[model samples]
Target chain A: SQTIHQWPATLVQPVGSPLSLECTVEGTSNPNLYWYRQAAGRGLQLLFYSIGIDQISSEVPQNLSASRPQDRQFILSSKKLLLSDSGFYLCAWRNGGILGDIQYFGAGTRLSVL
Target chain B: AQTVTQSQPEMSVQEAETVTLSCTYDTSESDYYLFWYKQPPSRQMILVIRQEAYKQQNATENRFSVNFQKAAKSFSLKISDSQLGDAAMYFCAYRSTFGNEKLTFGTGTRLTIIP
Candidate 1:
């Protein structure tokens, strides 16, 4: 079984502060990792996705950035956070092959930028 | 570009009743995939069901099933004997068969099961 871990579960950050959210997947190697944000009572917005290490594709232009340091370790970072950056951040992983790939999500990290 | 649409913004059903949530998508590709994800109050996105476009038979998982109409581009979810635990935001998602396809999600429909 594959499991994804994300932390800190919840964070309160002042505006313009640096931010870092980490996601690591165990029991799977070379998986496709994705970063998504969901606004209050709204649908999810894809921020970034990585197929492999050092290969990141950003869907939306924002203050946030994502990196795949290892085969199963992905990190979301920002040099300076904005008020609009506050949302529930989700890290998901899927199989890296041509089979029927279903994404498995982690318990999201809630960031409140005050 | 592929797009997903969930017509109902909110729906309510009594416990043990049945409810159908409508979903339609626009895609140019013949081979693709459609999925329904459930987001509970905890906000964890969980995969509820999935259907491959090339398949003729509708996909079913226990009390959950999908009506996949490839020509109509309609994929609707039917929840039978709805339980209180079924209350959540249901999102319709689409992914293309070609390339590194990313999922395009619909504006979810909030389902409330009245006990």
Candidate 2:
């Protein structure tokens, strides 16, 4: 069985503060990782995705960035947070190769930027 | 790029009754995948059902099923014997079968089950 862990479950950060969110997957190797954000009443938006270590693709231009340090470890970071950066962050992992469409999501982090 | 559309912003169904949620998508590819995800107040997204474009027979999981019309680009979810536990925000998503791993999601429809 594959499991994804994300933390801290909830975060409260002041403006211009640094942000770091970590996601790690156990029981799977070389899995594709993704970062998504959901606003209060809006749909989720894809922020970043990585095919392999050190290879990341960003969907939108924002203050947030993502990195894949290991095969199953992904991190989302920001040098300076903005008020608009507040939202629910989700980490997902998918099987690699052909036919890896279904994604398994982790418990999201509730980030409140005051 | 694939795009999913769930027009209904919100829907309500009485317990033990049936309800259908509408979903439409646009894509140039012949084969792809469609899915329904449920997000409760707890904010965890869970997969309810999935449909592959190549399969003509609709996929069913227990009380949940899909009416997939490939030509019409419509994939609707039918929940039989709906319960209060079924109340959640349902999201429709599309994924390319050709190789794209990214899933394009719809705005979602908030389903409220009345007691």
Candidate 3:
């Protein structure tokens, strides 16, 4: 079985502080990783996705960036956070080799930028 | 680029009744995928059902099923014998077979089940 782990469950960071959130997958390799953000009452928006290590694609111009250091380890980072950077962040992994595999989501982190 | 739309922002349904949520999408591709995801208070996304545009038959999963209209570009979800646990924000998503394979989601419909 494949599972995704993302942490910390909740975060409170002051404005202009650096941020780092990590996500890892177990039981799979060469998986496609994605980062999504959901506002208070809006739908989720795609942030970044990586098909392989060092092959990251940004969906929109944003304050954060994503990196896949390892096949199963992905990190979301920001040099200086802003008040608008606060939201629910989700990490998802998909079986790239499978035909109809669904993206599995993590527990998500509730980021509150103070 | 693909787009998904969920018209109803909020809905309430009585227990054990049937409720259908409407979804429409825009895409130029012939073959693609559609999905319904549920997010509860925990905010974890759960896949309810999925449909392939190439298939003519509708897709069903337990009490959840989808009415897929490929020509009309409409995909609606029907929940039978709704349970209290069904109360959540239901999101309709679309995925392309090509491109980066990212899911394009709609503004979700918040379903409230009346116990």
Candidate 4:
């Protein structure tokens, strides 16, 4: 069975600080990875997605960025965080072979920017 | 561009009762996919159910089922015998079949199961 793991389950970072959130998947290779954000009482917003290594597509223009360093390792980073950047971040993966494939999500990382 | 709409921001239902959460989407593409995701208090996005645009029959999973109307562009989720564990935020999402894997999500409906 495939599983997704995200680290720093919860974080409290000061404003303008650098941020890094990692996501890794097991039991699958060449999977489609995605990064999403959910503000309080808001819907899941797609921030970035990668079909392959070094192929990140950003949906929203913001301070956050994403990278796929390995086949199953994805990272979300920000040089300087903003107060609006505080939210629950989710990592998702889908089978690359299936078009419009269903996505499986990780436990998510809750970031509180002060 | 595809858009998903979930009108109800909050909903409450007594335990063991049935409730239907409505979701509608607008898409120019004839072939696409619709999905319902559950975000619990922990804020984990879990896939609850999914419906393919080409399929005519509704999709069901245990107590959860989707009323899919492709022509109407309506996809409603019906939770039968709702349980306390069902309390969460439900979101409707859409993905185009033509190489767009990014899901466009709705505002979500917070379902509260009353004891």
Candidate 5:
């Protein structure tokens, strides 16, 4: 069975502070990773996705960035956080094989920028 | 570009009753996948059901099932014997069969199960 682990389920930060949220997958290799943000009572917006190490695609211009350091390790980071950056961040992974592209999501992190 | 739409923002059903959440999508591609995800108050996404465009038979999982109308570009989820645990925000999503594993998600419909 595969499992995704996301850290710091909840965080409170001051404006302009740096942000780092980590996501790691177990029991899978070369999986496609994605980052999504959901504002209160709003739909989830795709932020970034990585196909492989050092390969990242930005869906929309924003303050956040994502990285795939290893086959199963993905990280979402920001040099400086904005008040608008506060929301629920989710990490998802899909297998690279020919199997159905069903994405598995992590627990998610709720960030509040004060 | 593909887009998903969940027309209902919120719906309510009495416990042990049945409810249907509507979802429709637009896509030029013929082969693709549609999914229904549930996000409870805890805010963790849980996959409820999935439907493939090529499959004619609707997919069902226990009490959850999807009505996939390819020509209508509609995929609606029906929950039978609804329970309080079924209360959550349900999202409809779409993904192409090839290239770009990114999922296009709808705004979501909040389901409330009354006791």
Candidate 6:
């Protein structure tokens, strides 16, 4: 069985501070990783997705960025955080195989920017 | 471009009763996938059901099913004998099989189960 892990479960960062959220998957290789953000009462918005180690796609233009350092390790980072950047961050992973289309999500990280 | 629409922002139903949540999508591609995801108070997304465009018959899980109308471009989820655990934010998503794997998600419908 494959599982995804994301941390820290809760984060409080000051404005203009750096941000780093990590997500990793076990029991699968070369999986598709994605980053999504959900505001207080708003729906989730896709921020970034990566098909491979060097292939990353951005769905929205924002202060956040994503990277795939390893086959199953993905990281979301920001040089300087904004007040608008505060939200619930979710990390998802889907199988890269031909018959895999279902996406599995992690516990998520709650970031409160002050 | 593909888009998913969940018109209802919130819905409530009494426990043990049935309730239906509607979802509509727009896509030019013929082969694709539609899914219903449940985000409970815990905030973890759980897959409820899935439907493939090629299948004519509707898809059903234990207590959850989807009414898939390809021609109508509609996919609605029906929950039978709703329980308190059914209360959550339901999201509809779409993904094309033509090499584009990014999922386009709807805003979501918050379902509240009354005791």
True contacts kept of each: 0.51, 0.40, 0.49, 0.83, 0.51, 0.49
TM-score of each prediction = 0.97, 0.97, 0.98, 0.97, 0.97, 0.96
**Better DockQ candidate (1, 6):** 1
Q: Weakest 10 consecutive residues, lDDT, candidate 1 chain B?
A: B95-104
User: Per-model TM-score of chain A alone?
Assistant: 0.97, 0.97, 0.97, 0.98, 0.96, 0.96
**What are the Cα lDDT values of the candidates?**
0.93, 0.93, 0.93, 0.94, 0.92, 0.93
Position B28, candidate 5: lDDT? 92
> Each candidate's interface RMSD, rounded to one decimal?
1.4, 1.2, 1.1, 0.9, 1.2, 1.6
Interface DockQ of candidate 1: 0.67
List DockQ for all candidates: 0.67, 0.65, 0.70, 0.84, 0.69, 0.63
lDDT of 3 by residue, A1-114 (tens): 888999999999999999999999999889999999999988889999998999999998999999998999999999999999999999998998665578888989999999
Best model number under DockQ: 4
Q: On DockQ, who's better, 3 or 4?
A: 4
Docking class of 4: high
Of candidate 5 chain A, the 10-residue stretch with the lowest lDDT total is A93-102
Q: Worst 10-residue stretch by lDDT in candidate 2 chain B?
A: B94-103
TM-score of chain A of 5: 0.96
Please tell me the TM-score of chain A for candidate 2: 0.97
Clashes in each model (backbone N, CA, C under 3 Å)?
0, 0, 0, 0, 0, 0
Residue range A7-74, candidate 1, lDDT tens digits: 99999999999999999999988999999998987778889999999999999999999999899999
Q: Which window of 10 residues has the lowest lDDT sum in candidate 1 chain A?
A: A95-104
lDDT of 4 at B80: 97
Clashing residue pairs for model 3: none
Q: What is candidate 3's lDDT per residue for B81-106, written digit by digit as tens?
A: 99999999999999887665688999
lDDT of 2 by residue, A90-112 (tens): 99988877493678889899999
